[model samples]
Target: MPQTVKLRPYRLADEPAAVGLWQRSWQLAYPQIDFSQRLEWFREHWSGLQLDSRIVVAECETVPDHLAGFVAVSPRTGYLDQIVVAPEMQHRGIGKALIDAAKHLGREGLYLHVNKDNSRAIAFYRKSGFTIAGEDINRRSGAPVYMMTWRPAADLPPEP
Candidate 1:
């Protein structure tokens, strides 16, 4: 069984761990991209989220300081800018926990753009109650992507 993980507000001190996790996770997903080259790229985006997003980190139950995963949601616009889980910690419910956290943060609705080729992530989002609402290209990499949105069950429209 997977160990329990506790979610908490992100602190300034968590930046290094959080960013490291971000890089490692992305590197595993898109190995062709050298994420290390984008450290400052991530820092710029992280700085923006730090100012306006509701950032939450999942802490390992037994290993207190070990960050298993994290999610960042813009409270004002409900955009799920980032959700990452450590490569070693994938599929242990950490990602789901982070999604649940983002759901609570974006009470009305949540929206995000996901890489089109990442079927694993796309399937995960679909299973999480998010539907593909549109399509677009990734601004940074110009890769094709899909727009996904999610709302609380109670807020969903009645079935036909």
Candidate 2:
């Protein structure tokens, strides 16, 4: 059985673990990419991340300080910028908990961009109630992607 997990605000001290998990998770998904360069790129840009971005990290009950997953959201627009779970921690509900935390921030809706080729992530978003709002190229990575949006179930239109 999976252990309980707690969601908490990101702290300065948690940066390394969070970045490490981000690096590893992306590495697994995009093995063809130059991860070392990507890791360094993140390290260089992480400090300049917008001050209004909200981040939540998941802590597992069995392993206290070790982070299992994290989600980042834009405070002003409720744009979900990133969500990554350690490969070993995937399918353990950590991602859902982090997303739930984002929803509790009082946003009526949330949106994000996901790589088009990442079928697992696309399926996960679909299961989480997100609908493909549009399709475009990710400016940063130059990859085709889909813009997905989700709203509270109660806010959705009634079924036909």
Scored by lDDT, model 1 comes in at 0.91
Which candidate has the highest lDDT of all? 1
Q: In model 2, where do residues sit more than 4 Å from their true spots?
A: 1-3, 155-160
Give one digit per residue, the lDDT tens place, for model 2 in 1-160: 2557777788888889988888888888999986778887787666645376778888887787899888888767878887888888887777777777767652678999999999999999998888999999988899999999988866544322
**RMSD of candidate 1 to the true fold?**
3.9
Residue 77 of model 1, lDDT score: 95
Error of 1 at 140 (Å): 0.8
CA displacement after TM-score superposition, residue 141 of candidate 1 (Å): 0.7
- Where is model 1 more than 4 Å wrong at Cα? 1-3, 155-160
Candidate 1 lDDT over residue span 43-152, tens digit each:
99999999999999998888878899899999899999999988888888888988988988888899999999999999999999999999999989999999999978
lDDT of 2: 0.81
Give the distance in Å from residue 127's predicted Cα in candidate 1 to where it truly belongs: 0.5
Whole-model lDDT per candidate: 0.91, 0.81
